[model samples]
Target: MGLASASLFRTCGAYVILAGRSEARLETARQRLGDAQTLAFDITDSEQVTEALSRLPEESLDCLVVTAARVTHGPFAEQPVAEVREMFEARFWGAYGLVRAALPYMRAGGAIVLFSGVLSRRPGMNCAGLGAACAAVEALTRGLALELGPRLRVNCIAPGMVRTELHDRVPEERREAMFRSTGESLPVGRIGAPEEIARAVLLAATNGYMTGHVLDVDGGHTIRQYATRQ
Candidate 1:
């Protein structure tokens, strides 16, 4: 998600600083981005975030997009507590830390775009933690929008099931069923790509009047509940 957002932003004439934990993946993403700068850091660590931002000039950032998250699939009772904690750290605290660090660098007219999943609004089995975290993301966006008011903009993009490597963890049968069902269920008849979600983020960041909004980049997935027909 971060990679997609960075690529889209760069293509749209923005200088992006890509940050992540894995050096190899970050390097690969940097190469794909052509000329963007890479800053490898774990967002969950405050010291790391502070150190990373210390290198940047004050008020130099035009936008900040937080797309880092972790997801796991399984029945709620069967899922491990530690894994659930990991998700919260990644999706919730990580984003919060990024926003905290980046806020100083963002001046008026600057924007912050955070990622939330469609499941925030449309719950699914075994996704309670993920859904809750995403819902918090939306709430944070709105709250920050109100607090930052008339200067910095804060918005969220809630995407439906996007085809990414992250989705590979789902059982094969369930994954296929998800694909088929989502295609039929959504108005667009297909799952979205990361690039599509990236586009929405770009739009939200650039558009001046679109603050405090949770833009659904989903294929209208939240409009109707998923129920089997008799």
Candidate 2:
């Protein structure tokens, strides 16, 4: 998701800095980015974040988008404690750390776009931890917008089940069923693509008038209150 967002921003003439734990994947993305900088750091580590930020010129960022997250789905009793903690660290704490580290580099008119999920509002049976993390992300976005007001804009993009490598983890039959269910349930009649969410993120970053907004790129998933009866 970060790579997709970075590609979108670079296409729009922004000099992006790619940061993540996977150096190989970052390099692959960098090759596509032409001249963009790549920084390998774990967002969960404060010292690493501080060190990485130190490498960048002060107040050099025009937009900071945090799309790092982890999702674990299973019955709560069956889920491992370590897995739950990892989700919190990746989805919630990592985002918080990035925001804290990037704040100084963001000047007036700059924007920060964070990613959440539809699960935050419409949680499922096996998504308790993910739901909580996403909810926290939305809350943090709102609070940051208020606290960082008038100069810097803070917003969140809550995406529906977008087709990505992340979804490949589900069993093939289950994945198909989920898609079919989403198509039947959502008014838009299909799952969204990564590019669709990327466009929304770009909009949030570029639209100077918008702030503290939780934009749902969820294909009306949030609006459909009742399942469609066939």
Candidate 3:
């Protein structure tokens, strides 16, 4: 999903700096993205983030997007404390650290995009930890928008189910069924493609006046309270 957003930005003529923990993946992105830059830093490690960005031309940064997420799904009672901590570390503090370090380089008129999810607003069982993580992201995005404005803008894209490798954890048959059922339940009658979510990220990153907004790119999932497949 992070790569998708980066690719979208690149296609739209933005110079992208892809950051991640995997050197091999970063190399692949560098090659794949042609002119885009890559940085390998674990956002969970504050020192690594600081060191990495400090080495870069900070003033070159115009937009920031936080999409690295640790996907966790399990009953709250069964979810390990360490797992919950890891989720918050990656989802919340990861964004927090990046913003803290990047702000030094960011001037007025820049934009920062963060990723939340529909689960934050419509969580089902076994998604408590993810929901909490996403809720914190939304809260942070809103607060930062107010605090960082009228200079920088901040917003989150709360996406519904999208066809990505994130769903590859499930078996093909089950995944297909889940997607079908989920699509039928929504007004759009289909699950989303990753590019759709990426487009929203671009909007959040490019739009001058949109700040503190949690833009829902769901296929009307949140509004269809009474709409369900038979």
| Tens-digit per-residue lDDT, 191-218, candidate 2 | 8888889999999999989999999998
Q: Give one digit per residue, the lDDT tens place, for model 3 in 84-178.
A: 89989998999888998999878669999988899898987899889989999999999999999998999999999999978899999999999
Ranking by TM-score: 3, 2, 1
**What are the clash counts of all predictions, listed in order?**
0, 0, 0
Off by over 4 Å in 1: 171-177, 228-230
Question: 1-230 in candidate 1: lDDT tens per residue?
Answer: 77888888888888999988888988998888899888888988889889989899999998988887887766788889899888889888899888988888887789999889888978988888789889988998999999987879999999887888787878989988888888777777778888898889989989998999999988888885465322
**Each model's lDDT:** 0.86, 0.89, 0.89
How many residue pairs clash in model 2? 0
Worst 10 residues of 2 by lDDT: 221-230
Question: In angstroms, how far off is 58's CA in candidate 2?
Answer: 0.3
Per-model TM-score on C-alpha atoms:
0.92, 0.93, 0.94
